[model samples]
Target: MSKLAVQLYTVREEAGKDFIGTLEKIAALGYEGVEFAGFFDIPANVLKNQLDRLGLTPVGSHTSIEQLVDHLDEVITYNKTIGNSNIVCPWSEVKDEESLELLVAQLKKVVQRLQDEDMILLYHNHDHEFKKIGENYLLDLLFEKCEGLYAEVDTYWVHHAGVDVIEYLMKYKDRVKLIHLKDGIGNELKAIGEGTAPVKQVMELMQKWPIEWVIVENDEPSPTGLKDIERSMICIKNQF
Candidate 1:
């Protein structure tokens, strides 16, 4: 069975104000792990201590490509200390062929380096990745060109991009390491069960795919953010 986690980006403000307290609350909400967007400059040991105390796992970190390239060593060391083996480039500004090629080269090197250290590098996407640069989608080109790179598929964006979410996941199922179960209608982000995305079909696919984690994310949560994810967790628990 796939484990449940929350992308901390959903509660960035609360986390920034009270890091340890926020984590305690997350654990109280019954999350098995967390996908970190930032560490708030906390010491690795201190952060890891809190996680250990609460029995929360560090699912992965959403480290940017720029950080992965310039501060690769620091990023790797911090994640290692926190017991996280996955480093994902959550977003990048590569709108054209020249920029895309540069990102591919940069990521290829990062992926190989991380692999040598027994870690994996992954890429997350939004609607723009589904846009075609030539004959292929930009995301397809990235996976094709960058060897050993894994995917952290965001199902909401894949649906927003007018693609069949399950089919898209199937196409790259072998390379998928994590999945974001954000639901929404068109571009409006919503809690898991409150949107139009094919949640049932995707949950069914998880049974066949080697997906390690299914994370809940809502860029804009309604009636309070934490409460929204709490509701989402119920939806995920019922579905899975």
Candidate 2:
């Protein structure tokens, strides 16, 4: 069976208000794990304790390139305390070839540092990453150059990019550790199963890959964010 996690960014407002309380609600809602977007002033031990009490596993976190570059040690320490092994770069703006190359070089070092600490770095993508540079897609180029980096494929973004998400999932099976199971139609984001991102077909294709977590995220949630994710959880529970 595949594990289900919520990218807490989906409930950023509630989380910003009460991180531990929000996690308790998430656990109560039947999600097995959580993918953190921010810490929100909660102590590592306290966060871990809340998660433990509620039977919620810390799957990973969506960190930025700034954090990875500037405060890597601090970031690693916090995640290690919370029992999160994967450090994901959610998105970055690399407008030019030089910037892309710089980012890739930085990633190689980041992954190596993570490896030393018995952790791994994952790269998450958005539609902009699909733009071709030379002959290869930018996403592929980054992975190709970064020796031990892993992929946290976001399906909605892949669809938005007009790429075959299934092909990427299969081709990079070995490197994929998580799948961002967001839904969308065109440029608008939606809660899982609420848009036209081929949720069922993607789940079917996922069987060919060894994914660790299928995380639900809504960049643009509907109504109340909590309610939005609850609906997404129901959709995932029924279908996946």
Candidate 3:
């Protein structure tokens, strides 16, 4: 079966309002798995039980780097209990070259600690990650410095940055385990298939890259997220 998952970030507003109820609706929509962003302050047992009832296996999450540093033990414990093995740094406040360099240095330590806990660190990238970092792009620099670090390559962001996603995937096939399967969301931050990303070729490369998961993430709202996401998921499944 296709590893079709909704990143859970798309419906962030709805989830923030009615977390478990929203999940029940998502589960009913034929999504095989989900990736968490927040827990809505629900207790771990209650959340875990709800996920169990929905047969929702959490593939990963968008956790803050600061939180991970200050509460590594608590963070790891919580993710483990929630049935998620991969805790990803969605974005950091690091923007400039100096900050990016410092962030990578810190990430090395974080990855080491997470390894000790028997989990992995997956860095999620945005359009800026492909921007020049002196000689190399920030994404490439991160890969170079952070050994054993797997990445969640956001296909849209790479496209937005004008980098060749297929080529990068080929360059780091072994290192890339997960992929965010949304299309282009340039300055406007459009929906899944509504932007300029090379949607078809990316999905084809994903299969060839032998990527593990194709997660749907839409940063902007459309008329209805479910319809856009469902169409994207359906298209990919049919391609498979």
User: After superposing candidate 3, which stretches have Cα over 4 Å from the reference?
Assistant: 238-240
Of 1 and 3, the candidate ranking higher by TM-score: 1
C-alpha RMSD of each candidate structure in angstroms: 1.1, 1.1, 1.9
Looking at candidate 3, the ten consecutive residues that score lowest on lDDT are 184-193
By lDDT, the better pick of 1 and 3 is 1
Backbone clash count for every predicted candidate, in the order shown: 0, 0, 0
Residue 30's C-alpha lDDT in candidate 2?
A: 88
Report the C-alpha lDDT of model 2 over 1-240, residue by residue, as the tens digit. Answer: 567889998999888887888888888898999999999988999888888899998999989999999999999999999999999999988656887899998898899999999999999998888888988888888888888999999988988888888877888988988888889778888878888997788787666556757888898788867888899988877887
Residue range 13-73, candidate 3, lDDT tens digits? 8888898888887777778778888778988788889989999888898888887778878
**Model 3 TM-score relative to the real fold:** 0.92
Backbone clashes (count) for model 2: 0
lDDT of 1 by residue, 62-149 (tens): 9988799999999999999999999999998877788899999999999999999999999999989888987999999999999999
List candidate 1 segments past 4 Å from native: none
Candidate 3: residue 58 Cα off by (Å)? 0.3
What are the Cα lDDT values of the candidates?
Answer: 0.90, 0.88, 0.79
